[model samples]
Target: MRMLRQLLYRLIISLRTFRKKGLRAGFAELGRTISRIFYQRAEFIVIARALLEQIPPAASKQGLVIRRATTREEIASLSPIADMIDMARFHKMFDHGSFAFIAFQNDQPVGYCWVSEEVDRNVTRVQPPLHPGDACVHDLFVSPAHRGRRIGRALVSHRLRFLREHGYKRALAVVRRDNVPALKVDKKTGYTNIGEMSHTRILFWDSFRYNIPDA
Candidate 1:
């Protein structure tokens, strides 16, 4: 009976290890063979959370560090997708008048936020012209797993303060109405909902789309 029990246990373990016999198993074997390789499939999410936390304490009272992103490479280095268009746009638009902030923990990039001096065409056409010091929160993307920890709020607040210090009177953060998390950050960070626009406005985004060659 003891022999039978031991055999059953081995069978169960073998099934767990090899029953599927697929690509995942092959990768697992590779991982085992290369014991020193560190694989983190969820690395993007971990970094996103870290980015949100690096906002200064004066912005939302969170204890996170904030620093200016010094170069286009620095900005691209922390991007999740690292697209050339995004990098070029950053280089073209970002300045002391407009700033970029990165969040880090233990020297690893976790999140990124930037303000732009450029104004949206629709917003400018419909509303009073934004003051020269006024800036817009262009993009805030954190990894999905690292959300709900107030990192967004901290980043925005820090940005607002930075803009104010640079003599900007107001800060603008355009959020999609359906984007619940972004809208939540808007409310929590004291960004007033001043207006709305149709999604048709996204037509301008065509210029930024990637042109993939036919397969």
Candidate 2:
């Protein structure tokens, strides 16, 4: 039942996108559906954010020691999270100017978040305007064992405060539309729904589209 509902939702959104974006976008969305049937999957991505000047308290209030992992050794401390994260890929992105924030509890890594000053448009072909102070949240994860601890919310809140202190005006985050819990946490932490994006992965090739607000 859940899967069926999601399919229907995708269909509706795709049709709406087609009507708004014209033939080229229509064909692109059609290709995404066709590719999915061939085992090449795609997903709708939600872009949300907090204006740092007026951020709110965390949805799940918890005290944690969050540190920016810039060096290789600091990042290695997150090996406990290796099951879900690829260390090599993390290293590459870090080298490419992305930053990582690791949260520690009782001296063990509990969660981590990645951010970048650049508004990440790698997922889409569209070239939208970017604000210099915008820091895009690339990923956020909390271990399943520590799920109820409100660690995710803590991480986000801390990151926002850090960005604000360092001169960032706003922060952006990417979440799947289906991730209800995350969306809720984001809202509680002062992130407003800003945009939607989707990307198709076919073998080594990828295509993307992001709906710019009022565009």
Candidate 3:
């Protein structure tokens, strides 16, 4: 029943996207949404501050400069690379005390990530709320032109170091279970599986969420 409902929802969304953005963009978006719903589940991972090893030499040699985004203007600058809606959300996250990092390659923004000591209610609502010393890393993205160069790994390493320096004891990251590349990167960077989460929405109305222990 749930699977059928999800398929129906995807159909509706794809039709809507097709109407708004044309066939190619619509199908692309639909493919991504359906892939996540059917093939991916969310996994929560934890990495202790003390266990965060040094950033790899490859990451260091990439000549990427990373810095925290501090103002609306800085957040707005991400528009060239990020969707406007996403930049707006990041601005809101900044207002809520979340730390945002931007990575630059030769003076152009190539990637970014966000870290927060508390969950953004606008985002996912985690059960067993975040502890005082826990930091959540979210919205990690690297430009397609710069991928496969260890840029994502470098972003995670830099965030871990930032959290450690700021007195956070552990860092938390959530990734889709079937995202082999992301999962491999997380494990290579020392994140350990801690739990799994799932969400179900009905008719754009009431929603249900489940948090399960990691086996």
Top candidate on TM-score is 3
lDDT of 3: 0.68
Task: List the candidates' TM-scores in order.
Answer: 0.55, 0.71, 0.73
Q: How many residue pairs clash in all the candidates, one count each?
A: 4, 0, 0
Candidate 2 runs further than 4 Å off: 1-39, 50-63, 119-129
**Candidate 3: tens digits of C-alpha lDDT, residues 84-138:** 4466567777888887888888989998888877765664343224666777787
Q: Which pairs of residues have clashing backbones in candidate 2?
A: none
**lDDT preference between candidates 1 and 3, better one:** 3
Scored by CA lDDT, what does every candidate get?
A: 0.51, 0.68, 0.68
lDDT of 2: 0.68
Candidate 3 residue pairs that clash: none
Model 3 has how many clashing residue pairs? 0
In the range 1-215, model 2's lDDT, one tens digit per residue, is 32344345556657877899987897787777555644553454455564546555465434567789979888888878763225655665677788899988778898898877654443212223357777777568888777778888888888888887788876766677788778877787777766677766554456767775822
* Model 1: lDDT to the true structure: 0.51
Question: Which 10 residues in a row give candidate 2 its minimum summed lDDT?
Answer: 120-129
Tens digits of lDDT, candidate 1, 124-181: 2211224455555657765465566666777767776666666666665545445777
